[model samples]
Target: MAQATLESAAAPRESAPAPAEAKPRRSGKAATGLLTTVLALLLALFIIGPLVWLGVRAFADTWTYPHLWPDSWTTHWWQVVFGDKALGVAVQNSLFFAPLTVLVSAVICLPAAYAFARFEFPGRRFFLIGLFAANAFPKMGLFVSLAALFYALNLMNSILGILIVHVLGTIVFMTWIPSAAFAAVPRSLEEAARDAGASKLRVFFSVTLPMALPGILVAAIMSFLASFDEAQGTYLVGAPDYMTMPTQMYSLVLNYPTQVAAVFSILLAIPSVALLLAAHKHIIGGQLAEGFQIK
Candidate 1:
């Protein structure tokens, strides 16, 4: 028995089963990856192709259909846009109002954000949901309704009217985003600070505020962009005397050459693009999604 056991132990073990064939699985994954890349490229073209074409049109002197590329390039439209007085005023109004709306929104909504974050009050969910009421309805319909109200209040055609309209677009982002941020702060940190003899206010300012600041800042960026991009409401309520850059696009598209409009469009997109590029990391980091959690 011992000799037989030794022979068995010394003998070569039966070969272990070979790994299941992976080529089919690897090929399937490769095919899926290739398909995803193609789809992504196509989607990118669909979204970005027009922007590229616009850039081309802005410089193209006489390129038309059937041409794959611009025939000639010129700076005529650029010079014309730069010299236009009305366009200058529109540019000024956008730059002026967007930042102020962000500031006003922060003041009015930050406290509300804090409340929603820290307090458990009756109707909290209802109120949180209500934040979308401003933007939930069709924007044109909402603006039309505001038009009558503004007319009654003697706000029509004034800077104040435009600012108010811009502020309306900001409330959701200002409240929801910052509130999400505040809620995400770990209570333990605040408790630790409190146990160390720090007051509630002090703990909030030192710990809570610092941690949630990223969300607040992301909200601010979004608010600024929305206010800047708003057109329909601004046109309905603040037109004729107080045109913003976006509202000015109506006149550009209708009366000016396509190249001229394209140039102005590029100008209008610059700030939005710059701000988005700057805050992209925060946005991609998931704060915007966190803001939608009404609970």
Candidate 2:
């Protein structure tokens, strides 16, 4: 009987059915998940609330504080946005300048970015740092200096002058993106193309450029939007003759109707939103850091 008792005592007690503490651990996890969800919802609301408000105000004929909803809705503001002659001209100028800036910036930045990615030489690091420095410096200072230079050259208020300023603004982003894209491309692929009797130019266009196209497209969109939304440079350089949507919107905000300004804001947001939505997959999938590994 003692042996039997000893055997019964020695046998495991079916692992004790896991302690009650396990329930608290699961509960803690559940609480953490709930908190995370709440925070995400709040963050999303914070970002989207103003945009929703702008849309509401754009349509509402009479919306003011203390009201949960607009008293009445109308398309009057949108009609004003489209029918206003000055706004039309401003939109046209912006359309012309922004795309032109992107084109010129791409032309200048592509080869420079490629060189930075593919070659190492004297002052390369210095040059790269210089690019970053140019970008980092306050736009006010740069535009102030450029204004003086443009005045001296009789380029002030000219499309060319504004284009030059926009190019300067966008070149940094353009170079950084394509450089990463080029660096990500395998050198072996280019070598193989060369070994197959392809010329350097042919290999680059066929192999390297195609691989980096997604990044290039993203860079182009950014450049376009940066130039499109430019206010300070356009104001300083293109004002009194050339006016962009942003500049016009700035004036309207201070002097014109709030509803009209809201309408302009919505119009200005459309192209950027459309482009991002269209290319979101490419933007998300493109690897910016992967190509930096030299091996």
Candidate 3:
């Protein structure tokens, strides 16, 4: 009789349905996920919205202040930007200064990098500190001195003159950048090359250079951008008759309106962006990680 009574009680418990609490826990998790998704979408839109608006404005015909969207659309801005004589000259000047500066910086800085990385020299830390210190100074402070120097040298309005200034200004930073890169390379690899009867110069050219090429390329890209984007130095030293894109954009804004200024800004940004893209592969390579290994 007791066993029968226990069986009757257990039978009712086994067949009972699951509790309501489990359903709400699942719903809460789903709600949190949905909220996160919504936030991410909003953030993406906020960041990308301005670029899209700029593109739309660039392609539009009307650039009046009041309208958010264009009343009409045209390619006149593109045609004017592409076909102007002054603009063409500005582009050519930019093309000349940027690469020349990059080349000059490499020529001047590569030896410094190699020495700092491969050799133990007295006051090395002091030299690197001083180099970085130069980079940290406000570029504006050097303008008057540079302008005076250029005037004294008869280089005030010349393209090559402007290039010399760019290279000088860029050297400190480029040397530091490549020094870090070269320092990352294994000393053993270089020593091994030497043990195998390779001359130091040959080892540097064939082995060290190939290994450090990526960082060197990145530094060159940076040098090119710095030369390309320099405004105050170029303006103060070589003004009026010579117009870089920044100087031109400034003139347009003061004389015309925001729309024209925006067009020029967009055009000015293209070459820098193109250079970064070209150097992207090297800058993102694994050379850095490998170099840092103590072995």
Candidate 4:
């Protein structure tokens, strides 16, 4: 009877369930998921909150601090922005120059980028470093120097001159993108086209250019934004005669009410927003890293 009792006790102890290990794992997973959800919500709020506030304020008739909502809403601000002749002129100039800058930059940068990608020679690294250095240099300093140079050349207050400056500002980015894009393209494709009796230009246009179009488009969009948002260079070089949306916006901020400024801000953002929406897939999917990989 003693042996029987001892065996029964030992069997019960040995058969006892393993301390519910899965419960702790389940709790840990739940905690991690909750943490991830909280972080995502915070990030979304941080980015989207300002944009929502800006939209609300743009149409609000009267919004003051500590107020959860505006007293009323109206389209008066939109009317005011559109009705103003000077604002119209500024918009027109900005529209013209932004695209012009993109075109000029592409024309100049594409060939150079292709050259850098395809055939590297002496001073190639030096040139690339110089391009990067120029991009990294202070815009204010560059604008000041450019202003002086433009003034000396009698190029100030002209659209062409401003276009040139914008091109210079964005060319490095444009060039680098296409260079990386071209590098990512298989050389075998170009060689095959050439073997199939296609000229160098034909091969590039038919094979390489198409392959790199997404990257090029992304570069162009970036260049357009850079040129469009440029204030210091535009003000310094094209000011007093050539006024763009950015300069106009600055002036409005200095002289006009908040509603007017808000309207202008929304108007200024429209094109950029539209472009992003239209080509978002390409912009997001573009292999920027591959473009920089030379070998």
Candidate RMSDs in Å, in order, are 9.9, 9.6, 11.5, 10.3
Model 4 regions more than 4 Å off: 1-22, 292-295
Q: Flag regions of model 2 displaced more than 4 Å.
A: 1-22, 286-295
How do the residues 146-210 of candidate 2 rate in per-residue lDDT, one tens digit apiece?
A: 87789899989888898988898888778888888887789999999999999999999999999
Using TM-score as the measure, name the better of candidate 2 and candidate 3.
2
Q: How many backbone clashes are present in model 2?
A: 1
Clash pairs detected, candidate 2: 184-291
lDDT of model 1 at position 211: 99
lDDT of 1 by residue, 1-295 (tens): 4334533453333222323544445455556656766787899999999999898888879886799898888999999999999999999999999999999999999999999999999999888877776468988888888878898999988888888889989899999999999999999999999999999889989999999999999999999999999999899888888899999999899999999999999999999999989989999999999998787
Please count the clashing residue pairs in each candidate, in the order shown: 0, 1, 0, 1
| Winner by lDDT between candidate 3 and candidate 1 | 1
Best by lDDT: 1
Which of 1 and 3 is ahead in TM-score? 1
Q: What C-alpha lDDT, on a 0 to 100 scale, does residue 64 get in candidate 3?
A: 71
Candidate 4, residues 198-279, lDDT tens digits: the string is 9988998899999988889888988999988988888887777999999988899999888889889988999999988877
Q: Mind giving the per-residue lDDT tens digits that candidate 3 earns over 34-112? A: 6766787898889978767776766787657787888898777777777778877887888877888888889888888
lDDT assessment of candidate 3: 0.74
Q: What is the TM-score of each candidate against the true structure?
A: 0.91, 0.89, 0.78, 0.88
Q: Which numbered prediction scores highest in TM-score against the true structure? A: 1
| 114: Cα error in model 3, Å | 1.1
